[model samples]
Target chain A: MGELRLMKGNEAIAEAAIRAGCDGYFGYPITPQSEILEYLMAEKPYEKTGMVVLQAESEVASINMVYGGAGAGKMVMTTSSSPGVSLMQEGISYIAGAELPALLVNINRGGPGLGTIQPSQADYWQSTKGGGHGDYHLLVLAPASVQEMSDFVKLGFDLAFKYRNPVIIHSDGAIGQMMEKVVLFDPIPRRTDDEIKKQCPWATVGKTPDRKRSIITSLELDPGKQEQVNLRLQAKYRKMEAEEVRYEEIACDDAEYIFVAFGTSARICQKSIELARAKGYKVGLFRPITLYPFPVNPLRELSTKIKGILVVEMNAGQMIEDVKLAVSCSLKVEHYGRFGGIIPTPEEVTENLISKVIGG
Target chain B: MTEEIIIAGFGGQGVLSMGKILAYSGVMQNKEVSWMPSYGPEMRGGTANVTVIISDERISSPILNAYDTAIILNQQSLDKFESKVKPGGMLIFDPNGITRLPARKDITIYSIAAADEAGKLGILKVFNMIVLGGFLKLKPLVAPEFIHKGLEKSLPARHHKLIPDNEKAIEVGKDLIQPFTPAD
Candidate 1:
């Protein structure tokens, strides 16, 4: 373990990206997540690790900068909130189509055109099911705590490079604004030019004298070739689904009822689980760590053992669709959520579960 | 034992910083701690608040509907958080901005002249530390030594020289607490 410090999640993401040897960070300042860029600018990582930190004029330019940097085989990233993320969707689609490896963080606020700056999980469908155009998938990781906020940056980058895909850290204002004690990892050195050239042979890092020039693009004028490309992307997504289904089961053993949630909602559900259990109700929490992979197997298996699964979110029933697909209607699957940035309290969640799921 | 506290006041009054310092002090003692603030527009010198949780074991949630302690610095905070404190919990307030006393029979209420003491000390910035000192004197979850260390760790190096004045304000605040004993 390295030094332990109490830091906010947004600030921790900035520090962790620097420590992870990220080559570049391009982002516009947005509420709830502006601290990420602010911390990076204050630290001046360029002085220490020679990392480039640029405040783009807009989220569109910022994500395109990520595309340009990542195409050159550099570990680049961008951060934004919901409205800003909506602006970056076009650039994100282009990055995904080009199969560029980069990290995109969404410190989610309430959505649908600048709804509010309060915390929300309404971007579940946008993050996991492809916020951008085309039939594609982003590797999404939901971090519930400040510690996980720091830890997931490295993990997101590693998985991005491993799969040659864009990875999204699906965080919300609750996790981004909250402060907790986190043990940061030891600094990892940036990948050298030689390493980048060897690992990402498809990188457009100027033509080599001995080899053919590498062209980084997503354009396929021929319809058949585009179909083939889509198939390849689908195969890659399947491989990810099979290999990277991550989740956490809290008190799931011998549970009669379970709450399915992710990101900030999962932490809220943890408290609800405690309250319900205190009232002699056998409740547990099934938290999906990787939102994209969805962790269908464990949920499918648990559906048989528990009486029912209640999907709780900060949105009005998005992940419930995924949970329903996972359970296949073997047991009752219901959703209870508070929309428009209204986070449901533990007592409310417990009361709703008792009246809605348990009573029904 | 776990202590969940809500500290609320005007944004410039260091409401969030007080919670942060207490959380840092808890971390210094190797305890699990979390600090969550009411961010965004609500923090623009309006009513701002933060929830700080310190526990011997891992803290399950940082958000809570009720808290064991409520440290209120303004009348709006008093009106908002007076009922949020659990029964048998403690409610500490600075009487400078409050026109009415905290009205609750189940919870214990105490008044600290934090703003006035800071005014007397000729530094308005030490008001939060004074209230923090009152809380620490009453609860003693983290020691004064750890709080001093927490000040060193939480403050920027450029502002570290002001720690002594803040310490003096805290000491003054420790001596000026007026416990509001409820009539039986």
Candidate 2:
């Protein structure tokens, strides 16, 4: 708990990174998320904490910079929107393969290509299903509130380092641009190089005479060794699934029907739940705070009682597949979504739920 | 109780800032609040709007359909938001640049020459503050004292000197409001 102030989600992300003791930030500005870079430059956390903040020439260059920084055992981060994140996929895969802990944020905008600047949850599959080229997973955290947008920065970094894996904070334009009251935490000290070396022994700091040189690379030319690496990564993901499946179940104890959503869609579903309940429908909400380690077991258990599960998203049903798989088709699962930056109102979500889930 | 409001005007009319101030005022009063603006290129010179909610309980969606209050500063905003006000809700407009009057019969409508008042005061930037005053006069969801505190929070310290003139514009706006009477 700390001082409360009204701030935008993007601005909160920048401040939280500073407070979280992040060592460096390399980013290229993009719409709806450019404020993150702007805030960092304006605040000049470099003077306060000696953190490095660089406006890279491009998204490709920025993510590579993050890889370079993370390889040195430094807590580094970068943020981009839809297309920019797409450009960072190759570097992200490299970082994941090297097991370099870093934080990546995608303040999503509408896109198959360079779509609208408005918000969209279309990046769900890109974030959770391994946007990069490899058998890898990013610990994806979806934040619905401006406060969660701030809080997840620290959480993502902690989890990233804990598992020696990259973490992604998947947010949308609505959450990124919207302003709300946020309680900021006290600043943490950036980890010194000795502490980083002690924790991340595999990190590529200058080779000392006391120990062997650690080469950071994804290239395991041997197929068997690569298979072993893949197995190890899978084991880590499985552990994450069992231990780190974060979700919120709202009024599900007596609910006959439930809406499953994440990020901004969860906020809209909260209102839909209220509207449905006012009309005497036993509706509740299930929000996945962690998108990658989907809350399969809890959802499967909840599906035993609920008659139907409606997945709502700001895209063309990206998360619905995960919801359906989580429930194992045990309960009737349906999806309601609005894509291409057309945000569905609570009334619209409510109407769709009544007609699709309740009536069907 | 919750007040879901939409304040819209042309870019640079301080529409979004008004919503931010109101939201900050709500926070100063220890209430839950959300302020969401229609961001992007539309904010340059076209119609701009912001949705603000202040409540005693936790707020849900920041994006909303109907609003408890609509404070429109121009004809474009009036045309866009006049229908979005909930029944028994309030619509406050500057009426300086608006061409068509609001035709809704179910809501309470009020007019204030906020832009003209700002002109008279020679501080054109306070026009949005004037309209904010009109909305607050009808529905003091956040108290004026909290609003003063909100101004302190919303504006950078360097521009704080304008707050008093903004406060004065608010008073002038309060005095200029004319409550609409329904015709039989």
lDDT per residue for candidate 1 within A1-360, as digits (tens), equals 698999999999999999999999999999989999999999999999999999999999999999999999999999999999999998888889999999999998997888999999989899999998899999999999999999999999999999999999999999999999999999999989989988898898878785568878889999999999999999999999999989999999979999999888898899899899999999999999999999999899888889988899999899999999998988888889998878888889999899889998
Give the CAPRI class of candidate 1: high
Residue-level lDDT of model 2, residues B100-124, one tens digit each, is: 8888899998988878878877889
State the lDDT of candidate 2 residue by residue for A261-296, as single tens digits.
999999999988888999999999999999989998
Candidate 1 - chain A - TM? 0.99
lDDT of 1 by residue, B92-115 (tens): 988886787787899989999878
Task: Mark the regions of model 2 whose C-alpha exceeds 4 Å error after superposition.
Answer: B182-184
Best by DockQ: 2
lDDT of all predictions, in order shown?
0.92, 0.92
In candidate 1, how many Å is residue B29 off?
Answer: 0.6
